[model samples]
Target: MAVVCSKADWFVTSCSTTLVALNRKQSGEPFVFDCSKAEKKPKESDGDNKSAGEGSEEKDSDRILAFAISASGKHVVLTDDHKRLVLFCTEPSWKCISTRWVVRRCTSLAFTQAEDEVFVADKSGDVYSFSILEPQKVGELKLGHLSMLLDVTLSPDDKYIITADRDEKIRVSFRRSPYNIQAFCLGHTEFVSSLLVPAGHPDWLLSGSGDGTVKVWHYETGRRLHSVDLRKFGLDSENTEKRFAVSRIISSPDGQHVAVQCEGFPSVQLFAVDCGTEGLLNPADTLTLPLSPWDVTFDSQNQLWVLLESEDMNVLLYQHFEQHWRLCDSECPELKRITDALQTQWHLFKDSVELESRFKHLYKVNFDNMASYLQKKQERLDMENKKRAAANGTKPNKKSKTESGAVPHSTS
Candidate 1:
């Protein structure tokens, strides 16, 4: 997967195993870092060999789960499925500053507004705060939930830490006193997969869920403001039930527009931020994509950058202009360079285990579609049979005795 961090002055791209930082103006020496060489920190001594064995068995080796650059664009942090967290300094040199081990595999990473702390959320429902200023210090536990946390972010003012869990609960906790809960934004039927406090909307929250709805909420009052069902975009109840969760919801830098990407969908939904309509999200446009985006973000100029899930590792850019968004006329050279490097990496390891996994994923998708189609066909046949029976006025057959005391008519 290729991830791009587009800021005002520079853009950084991170493939599965490498990171490249390029300055937009200077085009100077690009800082390249091979993330595959990031060393994992040794696990703490539990004094139990059985527990150690269990942990080792569950660990996923060398798979990057999430990565993010700080708001200031000076620091970068990435977490892997093996429970390793690595922080990097992007300036002067692309150097790994620290490699810390976590208790469980991390699901999301967010940098604080001050850029002094990095918040890490793990599958075990715990959030840990790592002090970037004190690189030698280990991460300390901040707060936790009963369900697995899917995403976490801080309010614009940095006064509250909002977290979304797999149980459809979004909890807001005071940042200074995390133990004190502020409010709960509820109503999602399925897991709340993603959350965002859009720029300039400090009191509002936007969340996407497995239920196929993007809801707008008044976080401070815990009130449901409005919601837009993605099902309106051609998905039905059956399709939504097949676990197509909204993968990401991002607001543009200026906060005037928002983009939503759902799992298993190859198109991006765009909405305008309608503050006048009680903070509702108004439908703007939809950008049909060639492939499902692995990740999506908007640069300073409100150009949507989509990193595609493809063998070629392409990144598509769409510019917002004249109240509409459209693909750029020309390709970005910097993005092309990053994709070329990613393709090279893929070719060198085409026969590796990753290739096998990719094949398995593709097979699963095809198998699921075939199964769904067959199931629907069977359902249609059953409905038709019932209709036919009704039309024929068919009833249960009755058994009767014949004149010779023999059972002449019997129910089948």
Candidate 2:
């Protein structure tokens, strides 16, 4: 497929099977012929389009179900319907390099920042990692979630991998040696169809589920940060009910917004996030796409690329600007209390030095650090007791208790 990534004034769309690049630069005759023909397909031919050597068997190798472009845009990793892995590099004039079979239909694929490695998750809950530079598979991690792997993604720092599965489980794994399982985020009651990591925050993960909820988590700590019900987001009403499932989620390049593409919704919905904090998606400021989309991407220029998976199968490029600010939800009392306690504790620590000056330092001690300081003081008391006991020829109470097989009694 010829992936389209354009600026704000330019948009690319497939019109009547023709890939047309439209330019809004000029209002009068604002259309540019970047590539008038969809190069991925050949010109209409009589039923004899398939030659003896180049037939359906070869076309099967050409059809790309899912793909990921390298960060450098030098390589494109693709998986075909036949569970075959392929890489198309620019150096060889768009040639497909068949690497290995994933054994099952691939649900998702991700390329690490290094662009040398690719991670593929199949329907069988098995994740395979391979080097694009090497033909051999490097590693494999199996998540025991007994369902299809909906989406797999690597952390921005490349230190961790996360997979969302049909069993409503999100499995996190360390990227390096042993590939130890980190944490399982479990809240979605149905299949989680999409996994996303925001650009600015390396610790946060987002999963959209068929259960009609979008869940967020701190991947490192396995703490669920937020959960937004799609029904509560106002898309579950009787008249404007959403028929399509959420297929993909993509964060804005600036990390201030997130776009979720659904199967039956109007289009990709853009959501705003609070600045300076890893904010969750809010109900307000939702931007609808031109059509129901299956995949979404925010490119280098901040333009939204939406893949409509209908019969026409046109890729819509939206250049609208979304204000990236999250509106704090007032209903979450627990989160409010936790955030308030944190803020108060933060201010207390910030004013610690000034507070110490108002009273005797007592070895720089205070309630905030009292527990450890008190433990040390108790150790001194225990040592003094031991010395007195030794001088008086008294057996240590702990030792006596052990000998007597009874609990010890000592004030110290």
Q: Which stretches of candidate 2 lie over 4 Å from their true place?
A: 1-63, 91-93, 136-145, 239-244, 288-290, 309-315, 321-412
Q: Write the per-residue lDDT of candidate 1 for residues 1-412, one digit (tens) a residue.
A: 5556676556776655556666655545666665456774554443332353335556456666778888867898888755678888877656789887776778888888898898999877889998899876878999999978989999988888899988789999988889999999999987888899998788899999877899999987789999888988764545544556787899988889999988767789999998787778989998888866767888777778887766654667788878899786435675565455555545423322232211122111325786677667666666666677788998423323342234466689
Model 2 has an lDDT value of 0.57
lDDT of 2 at 201: 74
Give candidate 1's whole-model lDDT.
Answer: 0.76
Evaluate candidate 1 by giving its C-alpha RMSD to the native, one decimal: 9.0
Q: Rate the local accuracy (lDDT) of all candidates.
A: 0.76, 0.57
Give the range of the ten consecutive residues with the poorest summed lDDT in model 2.
Answer: 355-364
lDDT of candidate 2 over 190-216, digit per residue (tens)? 667778888777788988876666778
TM-score per candidate: 0.79, 0.60
Clashing pairs in 2: 244-263, 244-264, 273-326, 274-326
